[model samples]
Target: MTASHAPFIAACTELLGASHVLTHDHDTEPFLVDWRKRYRGNACAVLLPADTAEVAAVVGLAHEHGVAIVPQGGNTGLAGGATPDESGAQAVLSLRRLNRIRGIDPHNNTITVEAGVVLAEVQSRAESAQRLFALSLAAEGSCTIGGNLSTNAGGTGVLRYGNTRELCLGLEVVTPQGDIWDGLRGLRKDNTGYDLRDLYIGAEGTLGIITAAVMKLHPAPVARVTALAGLASPHAALDFLAMAQRHAGALLTGFELMSDFSMRLVGRHFPQLRYPFGEPHAQTVLLELSDSESDEHARALFERLMEQAMEEGIVEDAVVAESLAQSQAFWDLREHIPLAQAEEGLNIKHDIAVPISSIGRFIEETDAIIARATPGARMVTFGHLGDGNLHYNVQAPEGVDQKQFLEAFQTPINALVYDQVHAHRGSISAEHGLGQLKVDEAMHYKSAVEVRLMQSIKAALDPENRMNPGKVVRWAQAGTRKENIA
Candidate 1:
């Protein structure tokens, strides 16, 4: 450790316990790397603060020492947002120890929790209260609410509820200046002033560290139904999506589109996960309905929708899960695509969103472009079709070295996909924030005015540029201070 860093570490240890201040490599390794292992960093120590007060104190100490702070939660972020840099100067501030469910107001349909609380735990708590916290994803078991709010995460339930930003009504944040801002008001309408809550929600800790949040909740659905349908093409999937919306209306809670290749990948990796359809179609969709009525009513509605869709030739074939186990099995196929891709090897991943009407053409054109660019490159395509966000990923062809393929095509493929996304009036990042992975690319796509505005906000909030630097937006010129930008 450097002579200058010792005092900072000692002060942190004094504030918390020596055990809470982890300096050993073995104890700090997990916080240094991201979930995908795409980013590996070095930190002098890992600080575990027990509550928001402790967190504020640690921030104050870091500010005093001029030590950069990387606020991390769960470390499941795909964009390397939570990972520290290779520089050993920074300290990782982990929120895992601040996990506490403060309150649950069932009457107001709101739940307040510390940022370190797991997403699934929030769901379970809401269920216990006979309410529902609808922000859900495949990583719910381990991903924390703080990380979700930081990235404004959107999961399957966005079609019915909304993204994490929508689910959250308020936040308590520790600013870079070592001050706490508590905006934890559960009011549905608070048109008080400029919305500081939103500024921190999707800021990815560049502005401040989100400590706790007051999340909106809804009455739990009485019955839930899941169905999988095979379609001839992406165009057909869009048609079926429109029809499902018309039939089920608000009851249609989730709608995910999966390509036949994606299904095959899942089936190849997990042989036991049975494909619901006998024959493979070009595209498949998994649509869900949450009924306030009864299971029979949901089933009848789904059957009617399927019959009409099939009769109109919008759906080639369909199957509705008869039991909860079967429904989970159906979702298992959808959720396992990323896992299967991981098993396959390292690949270029793009979390993109396009206009719902343009998805088919976008995929059709982009897939053809990718094929012509690199033959035998496998595309793993699937996501929330209802929301127009797709996890469009490219894998190395069979018998090819994964590392070599990524090194060869990651750049060009990203450009091609992002170009198409821009052409279709879409976003290169839908749910995942632009961590180190896409921060530069975001600069290229965003207008100068837009980039400047973001820079101004970062300068105003975190002038020192010490909070999770080099992740989101960057200064216009390298090594330039906030004053130079203005």
Candidate 2:
């Protein structure tokens, strides 16, 4: 290690014992690599702070040493938001040691938890208390609440309960200057000023390190129903989704759309799962309903909607879950899509969102463009249709070298997809934050004034640019600070 980094490591190890501070290359390897194994990094050390106080201390030490700090959670983010760079100058500040649920207020319908707590653990804790923490994701078992909050994660439940930003009530953060900002409150009606908590919500650690959060909760649904329906096209899926929403209203918790290619990959990768339908339909819509009333009523309502959709030619065929186990099995198929795609082959994935009314058109036009641009390329599109987000992916033709295909078509494919999204007034990124993965792409879509405003905010908050530099916002233009405030 360099002479300058020696003191920083010593201070981190002193504040959090040697066991908590990982300096050995082998120990810090996992934190340096992203989940997709696409980007690898090098860190001077890895600091595991046990609590908010320890986090503050670590931040203070890093600030004193003028060393950059990269905050990381469970590291399950699709974007390279949590992965450190290969500078070997930054210290990875891991929040895993702060995994603790502080309090659960049933009367107020809220729960306070440290940022390091896993998403699934929070859900389980809420379930234990007869309440529901509704942020559901495929990586719930590993992704931490901090990372979710940082990226403003959206998943299946967003149709009913909204995204991570909607679920969050408050956050406790350690600023770049080493001061703790205690904004943790469970109040639902705090109409104070600019809502500062939101600034760091999707900042991806560029603004500060999130230590804990107070999240909203809801009463557990007493009844639930799930259904799988086959449709002729994306337009049909949209039509069915609208019909289901009109019937089920707020009880409609999920509306996922999958293409025929997506189902084929799932069936091929996961043979244990039995297809709900006998024939391959062009599109599939997975719907879920939840209510405090009778589950039979919910099931019947779904069935009637499907029947009406079929009569209207919006639905080709449908299968309602007959039992609770069947409902879970259907959901299992939807949640395992990413894994199945991985097993199939290397692919280029885009997590994008458009207007609900424009999604059908977007898919139709984009598919045609993709086919024309790269003949024989397979398109696997699926995601929370209710939220207007789709995981549109592209797979190379059979017998083609994956690397060569990506090299030849990745840029053109992205141009075609993003152009449509931009034309339709859609966001380049739906749920995932603008990490290093989309730093340049975001610039293409965002205006210079908008980018400048974001950079101004970053400079105002973190003048030194020592917190996750070169992340969501470009920090290269942030000139050197004249003074140290802290």
- Top of the candidates by lDDT: 1
Give the C-alpha lDDT of model 2: 0.89
Model 2: residue 243 alpha-carbon error in angstroms: 1.0
Q: Model 2 residue 215 lDDT?
A: 98
Q: Provide the global lDDT of candidate 1 against the true structure.
A: 0.92
- Tens-place lDDT per residue, model 1, 1-486, is 478899999999889999999989889999988898889999988999999999999999999999999999999999999888898888999999889999999999999999999999999999999998999898999999999999999999999888999999999999998999998899899998999999999899999999999999999999999999999999999999899999999999999999999999999999999998889999999999999989999999999999999999999999999899999999999999999898888888999999999999999999999999989999889999999999999999999999999899999999999999999989999999888888888877877777778888888888888898888898543333442223
Q: Give the residue spans of candidate 1 off by over 4 A.
A: 476-486
How many clashing pairs per prediction, in order? 0, 0
For candidate 1, list the clashing residue pairs, or say none.
none
Local accuracy of candidate 2 as per-residue lDDT tens digits, 1-486: 467799899888878889998888789899999988988988889999989999989999988999899999999988898888888999899999899999999999999999999999999999999999999998999999999999999999999999999999999999999899999988888987889899999999999999999999999999888889999988888888889889989999999998998888899999888788999999989999998888878878887898898898889999998898999889888877888988878898999999998988999899899999988999989999999999999999888998899999999888899999999999889998878888777766777667777878888999899889878867645422211110
Poorest 10 consecutive residues of model 2 by lDDT? 477-486
lDDT of each: 0.92, 0.89
Measured against the true structure, the TM-scores of the candidates, in listed sequence, are 0.97, 0.97
